[model samples]
Target: MPREAAPSDPQDLAILVIDEDEIRASIIEEGLREAGHQRVAVLADMRNLLARIEALAPDVIVIDLANPNRDLVEHLSHVSRAVSRPVAMFVDQSDAGVMEAAISAGVSAYVVDGLRKDRVKAILDMAVARFQAYSHLREELESTRRALEDRKLIDRAKAILMKLRGLGEEEAYHLMRRTAMRENRRMGEIARSIVSTANLITGDEE
Candidate 1:
């Protein structure tokens, strides 16, 4: 079992190494320490990889494979999808298909035959930067999708209110807003509830 260091800046991020080979794991660990990262853990037994990783909760992950088969690569992909942390994978051989699979698995850095002690820090840095960039894009896309859905729900709710109460669009919107304020809830939430109830009541007609 490896010990963790005290919390520090981003440059000193805690790292997790998943390698069956002890020698290779040591080289990667040494390189990280040389680069100013003091918190590094190496895991050889992968019986419960994801569970162990969750327990450790490292900031980044490094997987070193000497010669991986298709199944092994696919397993790593599953691991990558489970964890949102930055992942750097090092392999001895290169194959276009394998590289593509690794990228699809959310690996930030996929190095082929480039696992040099001198280059570990730079590779880790690049992985972290790429992961952060991708995470930001995902967040923005999700927020935009939510906003569009809210707008649609509000429109549906407004139309229902207008038809039921014989009010104009503006009046319907203001009524929903005032109701939301009085109930201490978001307008979108109120709109969604109204739309759902209206749909349920009209289900038999449809």
Candidate 2:
């Protein structure tokens, strides 16, 4: 996290790291800390990446590009347009050369509206560093989320099964897990399906 020179509200300023390289990520995180940014979150695995970004309401977003992901570009485009935040990219229209330099360094930065160029450039060095860090964090977080979500879905599915089948918790969970595996789907997917079906059965949709 980068510490603020003057204390800013947590809602006022935040930075998110979205890189996948551990070593490079650390360097960026530490650099931001040294640069006086304290409100930072490293996103390792971003399951609902865009939603998380929206919830955090960060002042800036730094993404690490190992290769481009459609989800990322789409999210960025949506954020840049729909949300009040500023989404920076290395397009030929806006400072193409600087964007080129940044891409060469393996990072890109986006800030919210009303940030002056001079102020942004003042933090450019740190922004570049944080972009790499955030990317690494995003990958790690995503992995953790997958593991955690899997367990949660299993538990929820088990509860649903027990309620519906008058079976023990263990047996119910096992049934759902086996079904998920056989179907080549995630436990959450199965759980969601069960919920939807139940909703329909109970006439909750209307």
Candidate 3:
């Protein structure tokens, strides 16, 4: 699955606290307020979770689950994947397998027995930082993949020009470069157009 990048504001970070227990939710809310976070929302149950999250559009999501079942954890993981927000999950206890699975599903920060009023701010900060880092890495990876694909396209286009026009490799490359410069387009774009045209003419789908 692809990761989404969301905007954040340190001064006024909108936070959503998900906890069934009213007392725990208040504690978390109090801590956030004490830390100067004014925009905060608390969800008591998992009903209409996605719709509420979409409506609120919080910058950070702090979920405090007491003895969460497998289905609940999986559902939260799915929500984390669907939403482009930083998720900090606090559980009373964590299992090794479940933790690994949740992390793989894109939960930003998972805490075991780490739900304290004083630590809420710090954990939220850490979750946002981790989410940003992961999004950056994903962008870099996608860029690299696109670059490699473009390189291959250029190579294929050059080979096609050389074969059809009986031109040398340097001549083919220079011709493509000249056309690219004239059209004010990128070399990769020019190369892709050339390859597409060749494929169309020759009926070579590959």
Candidate 4:
């Protein structure tokens, strides 16, 4: 999902922290306040995380895992998947490697969609930077799955042009662009239609 624009006031930013340790929570709250965020709340019980999140609609959330709570994972998954909300857990279900390590290491965060990367970077840096050397490396993998799917669609569209009109690759690409402009449709939509027509032809051939 696309991220929306940031709100006008950064000082009005709200944050929530869920941690069993009161001292740690206070430190995080102070750090956030010093960074110019005004509204900060901390919950010691994991059980209240979801309710607070829904009611307050905070800009960022930090969860410290003194005691393991699988419920937090379940809640993040729901928010990310169902409502198209941005939640930060290392195990982004959409990103498999991140998701796996996120699950194992037990740090979870959620950000409202379109929070500036600088803000997130600040929070993560404060939280993760001082960790002991032994716990430092998380799954350093990124997936190109979305890019791969886009390329496959584009290739399928090119094949359709080749088979139907005997056009070369460059010609086919130009034809797709021309059609997209004429119809006022996105290039991806045109590519998808081409792929669908190609599938029909292949089915007939088989």
Candidate 5:
């Protein structure tokens, strides 16, 4: 099923503007307010950025870096990795490598020389869309990984049951299923318990 689109109304979103320069932060703040965003906060200092962000709990983050040094860029990368909020980074200039790094860091929007009040709303919208898409993909990937692990555990459990109980593969699987149903637990949980017990018993025998 197609995921629902993120809310487009700026009024509904809490925005955080991070910039070392007060003027630049004001510019971004003004842009957001003009776009009908009422819940906007600006931070000039970068110290304890993660902590501040945690306290603010903004839905979207706008970072303006006039001339980002290597350390600053790295800090932004860390924020990108740590924070799941939609991020729109505005930079004066950037090289190809830096752009690639920003994308790798999970930045939703990397705008170069695009810091106009009129453009802020559109950029924010784009950022939110990209963030949502990436989030969905990450969730799907994690779920697939977990499902594969569960299948492996179930297979190992089935093998143990077949050997220990002298039961056929189908019978072993049915036994686990019945146990899961009786306990109102997941099949994977039952499978994992069986595998763990079998390993423990085998180790003791040795």
Candidate 6:
């Protein structure tokens, strides 16, 4: 844990270390403390780990294992995916299969035979940075997907209006925009409503 002399919130840049080995955990914890991290915790096992992590509200997680088994790797992967926090996993030895599983489970940084007291802070920084970049990318992708879906809805609504009310595409779109602005709702919402009502009136599943 990096510590500053000033008071700090537990949830602010808080770090949680998961390691069964006390010696390794102490080394990492000491490195973080030396680096001025104020809020850091260490757990020895995975028993009720999710509830424990929820209570701690860690910003990032460090998982260290000397010899991880299949069950343990799976369990850690579940934890990695369940929480949105960045995870940095370190192991003394690993295979391609284990590494692939960790990557798929969303481990931000996976290190093998690279854990040292001096390297802890750097690894943590990299983990957090990578996670932030990935999260931003995912958000952008989601926004683009929503925009496409909204466009589809708007076009379908416009088509329905043109067919039912003898309106042109421009007219249908303007009607939707005016209704959206009047009601303080998004254009997508108005378009969806129009499409839904038209479907009901025509009894068409399409």
What stretches of model 2 exceed 4 Å from their correct place? 1-12, 67-86, 90-96, 127-206
Candidate 5, residue 26: lDDT: 68
Best by TM-score: 2
- Candidate 2 vs 3: which has more lDDT: 2
Compared with the true structure, what per-residue lDDT tens digits does model 1 show for residues 132-157? 45557678999898889889999999
Off by over 4 Å in 6: 1-118
TM-scores for all candidates: the values are 0.45, 0.48, 0.46, 0.46, 0.45, 0.46
lDDT of 4 at 127: 49
For model 5, state the Cα shift of residue 25 in Å. 21
Worst 10 residues of 4 by lDDT: 132-141
- Residues 135-173, model 6: lDDT tens digits: 566689999998998999999999988998999999989
lDDT of 4 by residue, 79-103 (tens): 4565445565432345465434443
Residue clash pairs of candidate 1 = none
Shift of residue 74 alpha carbon in model 6, Å:
17
lDDT for 180 (candidate 6): 94
Q: What is the C-alpha lDDT profile of model 3 across 113-185, one tens digit per residue?
A: 2234334437555433444455576789999998999899889999999999999999999999999999999
User: So what's the TM-score on candidate 4?
Assistant: 0.46
State the local distance difference test value for candidate 3.
0.63
lDDT of each: 0.63, 0.65, 0.63, 0.64, 0.62, 0.61
lDDT of 1: 0.63
Q: Pick the lDDT winner.
A: 2
Report the C-alpha displacement of residue 111, candidate 2, in angstroms.
1.3
Model 2 alpha-carbon miss at residue 98, Å: 2.2
